[model samples]
Target chain A: MSADADTKSVTEVRPGATPAGPPVGARQDSFAARLRRDWPLLVMAMPMLVLVTAFWWVPALGNVIAFQDYNPFSGGILGSPIIGFTNFAQLFGDPQFIRAVVNTLGITAFQLVFYFPVPIALALLLNSVVSGRLRAFIQGVVYLPYFFSWVLVVAIFQQMFGGAGLIAQILRDHGHSGIDWMTNSDTFILLVTAETVWKDAGWGAIVFLAALSTIDQNLYEAAAVDGARRWRRMWHITLPGLRPVIVLLLILRLGDALNVGFEQFMLQRGAVGSKVSEVFDTFVYWSGLRTGDFGYGAAAGLFKGLVGLALILVANRVAHALGERGVYSRS
Target chain B: MSTTKVSGLAPWEEPGSLAGRIGKGGVLALIVLAVLLPLYTIVLTSLSSAGTVNRVGGLVLVPDGITFDAYRQIFSDSVVSRAVLVSTGVTVVGTAVSLGVSVLGAYALSRPGTLFHRPILFCVLLMFVFFPGLIPTYLMVASLGLKDTYWSLILPSAVSAFNVVVLRAFFMNIPRELLDSARIDGAGEFRILWRIVLPLSKAVTAVIGLLYAVGYWNAWFNAMLYIDDTRMWPLALVLRSYVVDSNPLPTATVGVNGFGHVAPPTLAIKMAIVAIAVLPALVIYPFVQRHFTKGVIIGAIKG
Candidate 1:
């Protein structure tokens, strides 16, 4: 489908040029010849390149500040003294840093167990439904929440589950003591996981649906001819068909385990007091930014980066062994 | 190999299987309900007036009355209106700037064997894997003297590694044959990219552009971290304070009051502010969502 689009674009734009070669000798003058021939294209692309490089690349170099003492007023990264392991040392010593690591790992584990299989299960359920219109409507409803910002999701949950929230009001009306679902430390893991599943499950289902479409319809007919049971067919056919895709997505998820949503944790940290809600990103923000400890934050950031990189490498290898199309390498 | 199992099945054979059908139906219904109930409450609460909301102690299954007053306050309120404008300006302009840069860089990177291509590409990949800490980023933005400037919000996030990768993939999919054909016709690389590449890549470009726009629109962390001037504040930050933080009213902390202390938050106005903050993405998503699921430009070409 996309190949056709690329072909069409090629045909439309570069007309009237050397349908055989750039008039030859255009090789030496390839730079100028190319520019003149493709001025319109160059014109379209130049500004965007310059802008991106200046803004993103220039500031990206700032990552170097992570290694420096980083006094903003005195000078920039080059001028600041490099502090080496001191930042890393301080970070390891901080109890909050340790807690953040535990919390991050804990959340990743919980999500792996509880939220990972949700979209797969939901996709199967959706695919099994007989009504097309109902399927589309449900898909639409489920996908809407994915577009909402973490802020809005947090607000919605608070409005519904907080002290003065809808659920509490209902419990009060029924003359039953309302549960403090929002503020309770024990409920944090469940609450966070539920929110993630609610927002992403449907969106995540799209990949599964794509994979499902490749299933052969004739296989179903053949099974039916043999009078195979529905449950048996599902277990044998549907589950096996989705195995490659499921493995691929699982690998990707594992690669991202070290990095959860930073905004989500930051938004709720004040309420939960960071004791339970603190994650690696938020800890970096608080200790590094708020407290002006540049080295510590960078060290923490480096730790996450290393872990994430290792996971991606291992996950990709696993996927390759399973004969799946992992993230980067196709073969 | 001799004990292989059959994997096909027909629905009618199980038509009378009550347990199978009922279990499937029950699971479907439960999922549908679980997803829809919270959304229903938000829509209902947003529509209901404060009086209706308080009277019910929260949203009812069915709203008694609908009001655009929340939306009205969002547009009419001074604080909200300014924030909304800032967000709009940033998203529109920022997306354009980002798309412009990303497309060019991606095109350059997509041309394999170019000078320094591998190193540059590796650098971009490294960017995705690891990031320098926030403090360093903050100091960079601060030392660069971008503090409190609107540019602070737009520039730091301007070059997204993900978008570049997607665009690069998209460009790579353009058959070498086509570029060769263009070169044979005496067209330059830039010409081929603009005339041939840009138009055909619309869907991916649209998706990437929208992704950039939405990211910029919903972004608050950048503004929170670098932008200190309230005049430069975007709507996401305002939404964070008003809607997410639950201030009784939409308030600006910039430009001190007579007492020179922080202002009190108003709840009713806060709800309206939330509505306004989300309005742009809501208005724009339906228009571009079709392009969004195009797989981040990862896949083999059909040719």
Candidate 2:
């Protein structure tokens, strides 16, 4: 069914094969006739156009706020004072902004290095479970946390690790003083990374599990028949089969590397202090909303967006060079 | 494909050495413990009496006494009850609107030779790379007078590009001949979509709807950004402020009518809030877990 659909769609794109082109008047008439025939499809697409225009394109155009003073009460976008490059200059000079960038990079680096392999490891562990029911139960348990809000995750972590938390209480019961794991600035990054893994590692493993299932079972049987041990078969067949997906996910992760998450940091920022917890997103929120520095905050946000765009483009290019399908293909 | 399905082990596939089995069991046990232990503590603590919670000085490992007082207090409080209603309303309305917009768009775009197909798809795909940035989006919402309104929560995120693309891929996978035969029978696009495409694509549609519903339910950041009125806050936002931010629950304002003036134990209250927030997802997740792998794999392959 899918193959037939693919071929039909492919044929729909074939260029006109006639010896002579239709006359200009005929072409115009045909365009109108085609529109008439496909008006329902156009109507179906209209809501999307309206929505994308109002929400996406309009807000995207509001990126111009990065270049303006942007007082909400001072008229609007048009009435806002134009200040070319001033916000950018201020953003670069601000030490807090610099700290946010440094923290974002630092946290993203930690996630890329330490957090990336966790799901693969998890998927492999689950795949080795011969009992299907046990595997399914484990997968369900692990994936449950992914649906939890950061607010709830943070609350759970705090209840476990806060100064007056379960762990602290346990320690104090043993005649030792309580430890302030949640509010300690030095370990904030580690804490957030642990929370992320706890929340998402299992969910992330679903894709890897899917990839693992697609590996030919015959390959494993053949390897076993030829005196290959279980571990050896996994090393030869499983890892190689998962390589493309790993690389694809890695490239996609790089594109989002700068966004090290907003809500998690925002929720926890007060407990850990801004010096250690200020990521790019929280920086924008604090500056724009709390301090009322909309222009500088917008400039910082715009900078992050542009960097993200460039990183995705570069990643896609590199993926194409490696002969792998990236996030999108160039038709 | 069925060759590997023998009930007993194949000749080449012996159960591993005893130590290997033990090691695997230990690791799996540890993983399961890591997930369940925290949850167990939270529930036990929530059920523990206020005296036990206070005496323990934190989360209760063992329930000294079981009581529904904490849950009772939370549901009785107008603030928490109102927040729950707000969250439910937002999730229902938002999911319906999002699915409506996404289904129409996906069906239209799934037709290969549809007018402006390439450009529309390109526009939607562009959303993956270029975010409009926080300050600008806030400015847009505020300027458009959606601030402090539920529309602010529902409109800006009405159509997810990822959902649209995933649904379109699923739609395109339906047999071309089925659609063609329907067309030959003089079925209009709306009729064919309603009578055929939608019915055939229930699994993906349900998966997408669940995703959107979960997203809407769990969403609090948008509320924090756009909502200035405390009365309009969702449960997640209320959870954040009351529990994570360590703010005292508004017991004084909740009035002293039903029970005594004494407030519930803060720890029990906090855990109960977490429980309230997570209960819905836990209820619905098992039914949807099987579909996630299939839906995600489809989206990944199409992408």
Top of the candidates by DockQ: 2
**Candidate 1 runs further than 4 Å off:** A1-68, A74-76, A79-81, A321-323, B1-37, B114-116, B175-179, B248-268, B292-303
Per-candidate RMSD, Å: 6.7, 4.3
Candidate 1 C-alpha RMSD relative to the actual structure: 6.7
DockQ of each: 0.27, 0.52
TM-score of each: 0.83, 0.93
Evaluated at residue A284, the lDDT of candidate 1 is 84
Residue range B1-303, candidate 1, lDDT tens digits: 000112222344445378877987787778778766765666666667878867776655676888876666556556667777898899889998888878887887665433334445555555654555566567667867888888888887888877877787887777778877887898776777799989879988887887788788888899888876665678878777766666533343443233212444333444455555556666876766656445331322111
Docking class of 1: acceptable
lDDT of 1 at A183: 77
lDDT of 2: 0.82
lDDT over C-alpha atoms for residue B177 of model 1: 80
**lDDT tens string, model 2, A1-331?**
1122223334444223221322112233456675776688889988988888888888788889889988877856789999999999998899999999999999999999889999999999887787777777998899988998888888888888888877888898999988887899999988999999999999899888888878888888899989998789889999999999999899889878888979899988899899999999999899877788787888888899899888888887777678786556522
Return the clash pairs for model 2, or none. none
